[model samples]
Target: MSNRLLAIVEVSPEARIACQANGCGHAVYKRIHVVSINGSLQVLGSECFKRLFGGAIGGNPAYSSSDGRRLTDAERRMLQENTAQLVAQLEAEHEAAQDPAREKLQRISQSGIAREASGGPPHRFRAPLPVRQPAAPRRHLGPTPEAIRKYEAQAKIDVRAKFDVDPNLPGWRGLVLQRITELSKSDEVPD
Candidate 1:
């Protein structure tokens, strides 16, 4: 509290600097800023903050209730609303400047000679190029999960059926039978 501007560096807010090199005794709260210049409380900046702080109690980052604690959700929502409004104002300012800038560029282009030719050799024109259009996006195709599972199960059954050893032919191997069945269905492979 002792080092505070309102307490230690009491200066008339109307004047930028006090007549006294140490400090001023006036209580005016407009048109001046107080800074710790040279270890003394001197009016240096603008009093815009002082005048605005009265209405900006809710906007103050240091502001707290009588108990000096953090703000509630309502306070946070208010701050968000205020910030969004300020951003909208700044965006509108940028949007307004674009039109004048384009107009100025257009005027400069019309008056200026865009091309300068130092007569050496005239550039040769190339033959007409074919117009190319962008191709359509590709699509992926695949068997559905149920269909794939069914096909795999069928293949497994075929292997099991062909691999079963027949008692009539003692030399007949199930592996050989399976190979024959696979060769018979060679055309059945999917593209």
Candidate 2:
């Protein structure tokens, strides 16, 4: 009979995570994980057995996929699907092993809001409510629809007097020079 303890070893989806206390197999993908079967973790996949025991597994009785050609598309797809399933299974098992109550509580919390929490309408925004006024006679200097929409939505309320539109207003040159001076003298900035 196979080692009962060895049967429970399982591999994660990326093949890097191993379920069970004894993390075995060379790569994470090859880590044998235990899956419950018939109320016992004694289901050992043949591929994993071959990898672990090699020719000694069956003493060269049956055929070997090791001596086969490249894997077909079907095989590849199956591998991907199996990996995903195994990973999910092993992760669930791991969570059960490590603070199972926390995991269960997390699942319950993610099951959507309770009916008691739905007392009122969902909160939402009602900004710049589209109240299109009647259009006036054509004005040549009017902003393009796209430009007007863009600006309307994100109209810069540049309260900073630095960028004020007045032509004679002082610029940010003083601010820039002060920043440069502070940067040069301060060790606050890292290279």
Return the top candidate by TM-score: 1
Which digits, one per residue and each the tens of the lDDT, describe model 2 over residues 89-156? 44555556678788787766654344226765444346876899998979666445654444332222
Worst 10 residues of 2 by lDDT: 60-69
Encode model 1's per-residue lDDT on 59-173: one tens digit a residue. Answer: 3221121222222344323323453343234346546767799899786654443332444444445798998988987876555666554545455555557565442354644
The local distance difference test score of each candidate is 0.39, 0.40
My TM-score estimates for the predictions, one after another, are 0.20, 0.18
**CA lDDT for candidate 1:** 0.39
| Poorly placed runs, candidate 2 (over 4 Å) | 1-22, 25-51, 54-56, 59-66, 80-191
Q: What is the lDDT, from 0 to 100, of the residue 117 in candidate 1?
A: 45
Pairs of colliding residues, candidate 1: 33-44, 33-45
